[model samples]
Target: MAPPTSSVELATLGHRIRHQRLSAGMTLDELGARVGVAGSHLSLIENGKREPRLSLLQQIAEATGTDVTDLLSPEPPNRRAALEIELDAAQSSTVFRRLGLAPVRVTKGMTDETLETVLGLNRELQRREREAIATPEEARRANTELRLAMRRRNNYLPDIEALAEKQLRAAGHTTGALTHRTVSIMAEQLGFELIYVNDLPHSARSVTDIENGRIYLPPASIPGGHGLRSMALQAMAHRLLGHQPPTDYAEFLRQRLEINYYAACCLQPEHAAVAFLQQAKKERNLAVEDFRDAFGVTHEAAAMRMTNLLTEHLGIRLHFMRVSGSGAITRVYENDDLPLPADVTGSIEGQVACRRFLGRSAFEEQNRTTEHYQYTDTPAGTFWCSAQTGTTSDGEFSVTVGVPFDDARWFRGRETAKRVTSTCPDESCCRKPDSEALARWHGRAWPSARVHMQMFSPLPSGEFPGVDDSEVYAFLDRHAEQ
Candidate 1:
């Protein structure tokens, strides 16, 4: 009754089976005869084309006179990420799928009763996530999927915008910031009550208590503070839009995207934003600051809106980055033809972004209060970018907006003549120029000790954001026993 192994792990097991059979000077036919399985099926299992059941594995082990543990042992990973990446690539590629293999979902004892137990446990886990009580791993996976989904959609949603705009126009707040009054008015207009609580935890942004027909928002989520207005509206959209609990990751993200779109629509009505963007695009003066000042929203909000406008409205594809103070790219979205650097997990988070990039360079300036601009040349194309640092209750982060050279004609910072060359993903050392260009500067640096500012350290696991993966995996494993 061993726990079911991952596809990659199963592959390793198959390799072990083949190795053991070879050492015994036995062909697949000989092993199949000994294990009471067809040689053709045994060959498939040996070549990692099939995942043998625990009983089959046990019988094979017995036939070979080898311990099951010997076959199940994993190779020493020099780096866990390398293996994860390989697995991800294999799972995505046609090579593995063509062999009649499927990616493993269950990670525990796979019996008939256990299968039902896993299904029940999965449903319960999903229910918890729907209520915003997801485990750390669940949250991270969902967040990753959601980010990828957003990227795939180019961070633009036309249908969602249409819905949001309709709701906004109906509420009588079609353009500009959806003030507290406007949100309240909308709630009243929709015949729903709004409740604000002082003691609500920060993480609990909003709760659409559908049963009570009231949308609850924390005092911190009040509309006036930067993105707070949209945050409040996001919660309201759930109830007003009549969205049910999402049953899967994609659905959850779509619903969330729609909710955020509804929020953004209230702040930047399509008509007004489009007119502004069209004027700026025509004038080639698309400054995010100009948009922020004109719209009275946060720089990040303005930058996010710019992507929507450019990609969906203006037909100018672009890319954006939300980088932490420590240089980790917390978020990235690109609709352009160029590829951005990403880690094996299809993530940019926790990976150091290039220092020459505006997102990272903003940190180098002593006063981060102003927007930093840069023009970068990559193999793909030239890009003009502007980034401004902003603080949150959590910590400070930089938001950047950039467009490809041809697309830059509509952007404000495009004319800034200064240029920086970036070989980024290939040439790792943007800290100085190339890895070879460092010369003696690496060891010759005699700067004063950097004062340790209070920075938000990652969770204790050093991998997940708020929840420990081991803790989550163990929790799920326990539930699997049910």
Candidate 2:
């Protein structure tokens, strides 16, 4: 008798699991360990010679950095149906992509029924998009009309204020203390107040008080000022009539202030850092000092480029390191491929230390005493490089690259401290053999050894900083030479 035929569904699941694992640069043994299975068993499953149990399927999905549902339903999905589901998902959350589930499922079914279902879903999606698109324009027009009506309402401020004061007095406040300036000061202190103090250029001098149960602006006698006062008064009235003031005004004020500060930070240099990052993407290698000189900003600004690239654009988490002797470097930035533990030390001797790989020929030829190094370790293996920056540092700032090392690298070449050579001695060991202290000391000799990195995905258009991109590519390409 022939062997049992393998289920196509099981085959599909195995294929997807293998794909995700490979994409993540996980070895078969590593993946098997994560999934609680032997590598040989996983190989058989991937080859469709053995069916994975349900629990094993879950483990495979988790180990491969994918959703269990995605692994279970790995049949080729109908493209059109998948798109429709994706659009629906996007409507509810801006970060729908993080859901980690393929939106559509492919299976043997009724041909006409699937088509009709997809068609209906597509039509509904289009309707929703149309409504969403139209609502913003409609809101703009409504806002304009509302403003016009507000101007006409400004004539009633005195009456409104009188009524408001009466109510406040009823609620146990001295009416005499309710002057506009007093209220403005109180509102400023309270912080939750959203009262608009309109000082329009052409408008008359008036104070709009949208506080303490009143919607009023001091009325202006002149025509131009009257219209302006009316608008301001109208805005106050709308707020008073529509909603209650925040319960904790102080807290509200604090929150608003924080938000304002964040906005200011985002808008500073008018998005110059984001632009530079985008430009840097086009290039293979980037020089920090050159970028700062061109943009007229600080090292922090240039560093933000890399931060945004990794965290925002590529969805990668970054680890920051400030080596005691080495200035600062981005130690690690990785997606699912090479997830480093959060508590991993960002130092070479402590975890993974960076070693400058300056060529012997160049060092001998130039008699260069100091060198800068930058390197990253992924599951694929270690990558290293060096670069020159214009910024110079004293003993305060040293050039250094960040490296992620397991315990082995952290402890390697560390315990051997015998004075084998006579040329360099204790306290003046300029030519010490490869050791952790030697690496740290060499990094400190430079002004600033910190190398920055930005990790972002290629855009759909495939456009990036071509010159810098080429240089970076060349550096990576010449990794064997280094």
Candidate 3:
């Protein structure tokens, strides 16, 4: 056999050689004399400190009366050797090195139980380190990957559409806007009841009590316009979709997206949404606000629904953006080749959109009541975009829907005279400061930035991201009696 290249193989080979030599009733010196090497050299090979040549291995095998193949087997000679090998690997790991602790040397005095305990502690340390490492960067990477997958399919999910349609049909919803009563019926059909509570967990929008066939939601009226119906539907979606507890941050993100998709489908039944979009397109008057009013959903939700349906049903491609007041792109999707700004990781979220784009420019408009339209010429191509500003607890944000120049003819705002050009991905665009102003203000500005601490923290640790299981359980226990 060739010399062992990995430490693991070397350790295993050393253990096997030592085992065979001991079974042959020979000391290290006895074996070394028979194999033509010094006793100390043999000791180094036995301790896995150095690799033995193939010729020496063959000589040792013959002297020990064992086949070379037997000596080369991968299994450790005993459980003690296996534990020692595991400890050797753990001590050499990056996590171990980061601790700046000295490696624990294996000695004859160490017991198997002590080795097992140390290995258990190392495993727990590694797990905690991994949980801590699930930071915003990991979230961005996961979001970027999810966005790419959604983009490949034009941001449409046929399975979710079918599910929504099936549930709506069962709920006797053949109509205009989905009613709260209909949403309740859909949940009932799935063996779940919507329970309103004042003490819903702070971290959760809604929680499902699968054991009691109940979903706990905030105390909002059922038929009210506070998105209570959507919340209930999203909670029930977990059970309807047969979702398991998410194992990682990526899985958590995927489940959140899926549940949100299901909620949107329920809010605007796919068949009705497609027909509404089709008729709007036929009249060359497609507008997101009209769609939003027709479905009784928010402007942002309507824009997102358009992303889900336009390419799949109306045969028009588009992009969507939700930009914060500070110009950071909070949510984004594009299959229309719009040159949205992105970070080095291909993550668009948290990166600022160009001030010239409709997403940012709309925020500056005095007439925030109506959707603002703009034509932006980017490196990829020109896009006609419509943006509407909305305010939430987090402050102002703009929801934008845009399409390629050719597809603009099918929309209502194609004739808007607001046109601008952007050379984003270049510092001279909106990102760079004015040269003359910079020269005047150099070393004069000392403004403190508002740090978003949550962004720097690791993702909340639990089976469900951002949820506290103990609080949820206590809430459920309190409600279960009623």
Candidate 4:
């Protein structure tokens, strides 16, 4: 009421300017020189005793690497407005172009609320500490609870909105709105300060501003493309919900394994070992060494894949047998009811085992009767094959791929020895088969074989393969002469 208290307003402006100047490492005299004003006038302006002209303000802001609007912006109840202004300026600035992403805005109102809440919490904590009522353990527990609660709430609006923004940006979309209510709830759950949430706009296509952090769900009419939306949703869920234990880990592993195997199959088919299986499918012949060569995956990965294929895909109950003295079965992973050996050391590579037993008499018998079949080999020892023994399925011939061990080997030299040793009584050795040799074997095994093969063919001698550097240089030389 007394002259509208200009001093407080001037003081606030002065503080912001002073802070900006100091942050930019500029002295009062330097700032004054750049603004074309007297050092004393600049000092007075900072001390809240005088108001500088708009032009001078612009000059000062330019000198300090900021905008005139930012220098003259009225201090709002919250910092969100200030943040928005800053983001707007950044969007137009040269630096923003280099970043390649749109500048994100934080609002003054949201910042004020966040600061107030933090200050309140700090004060409460300090009071408790001063009263000798808050122990370190209590503080830790409180912090943990707070964090968990925040994480849970993060699924709601503002929090969800922020996450959606990130997701949109990642998906190569920009400029979208998220509903305020949705973002607020998500923000509340996630324990993030509201200032972070205020950056999102409300309503956008190709971008969403969700009200309650439900993820700015794409409208049903939009193409929501396969895999992309699901992936983004999963990412949003993870961010907001903090990954719910078993489900999260399982899903994460499943995705990781799928991607890993798919990439391996594409980039290095031999390493993935699928090439051998694919070859067998085409040629109707399978060899243990060929299996090993085509699927050059690690022993553990091979085992897991085999287990997955048999138990989940093929619906087969496989008894993993370990060959002991004289090819006698020492250990086995039979049905769940069958007890596992306490002292068994080695793991069977399931896929390899499946291929070995395929087309054998034992496998045929098992498929016909849906029962286990037993066969004896001097090198591999007595082996049992079963099909659909534990689970209901259409009775079909099943293969036993072996990760051959020492007892399975008929060879004597170390180089000729199989890569893996069997734990069966026979204790055969197994080795990766040579592809060329395996190809010849397949040709013989199936006389009228029509096989799909991927081979590395040698280049013909008449023409240079790919771009010939010498030819390219020669052409360039000829062009220059012309």
Best by TM-score: 3
Segments of candidate 3 deviating more than 4 angstroms: 1-133, 222-224
Estimate the TM-score of every prediction. Answer: 0.62, 0.24, 0.74, 0.19
| Candidate 4 per-residue C-alpha lDDT over 1-482 given as tens digits, one digit per residue, 9 for 90 to 100 | 11113655555566667768887998898888887888888889876678767667778778888876666556732354333333334354433454576544334345656644544554454444334433333333333343234224321123333444443344343222222333334434543322222212232111112332333233333342322233233433544444432222223333333333332222122212343344443553433334333434322233324433333322333334433212223222333222222222122211133223322234334344332323323243433332211111323223333322322222112132122213422223233446787777865774676452412232211121223445444533543343
Clashes of each: 0, 21, 0, 76
Candidate 3 local Cα displacement, residue 327, angstroms: 0.9
Q: Quantify all predictions' global Cα lDDT against the true fold.
A: 0.69, 0.38, 0.88, 0.39
RMSD of each: 13.3, 27.1, 8.6, 27.4
Best by lDDT: 3
Q: Write the per-residue lDDT of candidate 3 for residues 1-482, one digit (tens) a residue.
A: 55678989988899899999999999999999999999999999987889898889999999999988888888898999889888888998867987999998888898889999999999898777656646787788889999999999898889988998888899999988888788889989988888888889998898888888888788865444548988888888888888998767778889889999999998888888889989989999999999999989999999999999999988899999999999999999999988877887799999998889989888778999998898999899899999999998899999999999999988998899989999988889988899998999989999999988886687777677777888888988888888
For residues 1-482, could you state the per-residue lDDT of candidate 2 as single tens digits?
12224455545555666677887899789989887889999988865558777788777777667877776664534453343334343433422333465545434363646755755665565545333322323322333333234224321123333443433344343422123343333334333232332322222222223234323233334432313322332333333334333222222233332322222222222234445544554453334444445543344343333333334442333232223223223222222222222212221222222222211112222323433443434334443323233233433222222222331122112222211221211223333456777677875776765453321232111121112444434433443242
Residues 223-339 of candidate 1: C-alpha lDDT, one tens digit per residue? 466655676778778776788755544466567768877777778777889898889878888888888887777778778887777777788888888998888887777777554
Ranking by TM-score: 3, 1, 2, 4
TM-score of 1: 0.62
Q: Show the lowest summed lDDT stretch of 10 residues, model 1.
A: 456-465
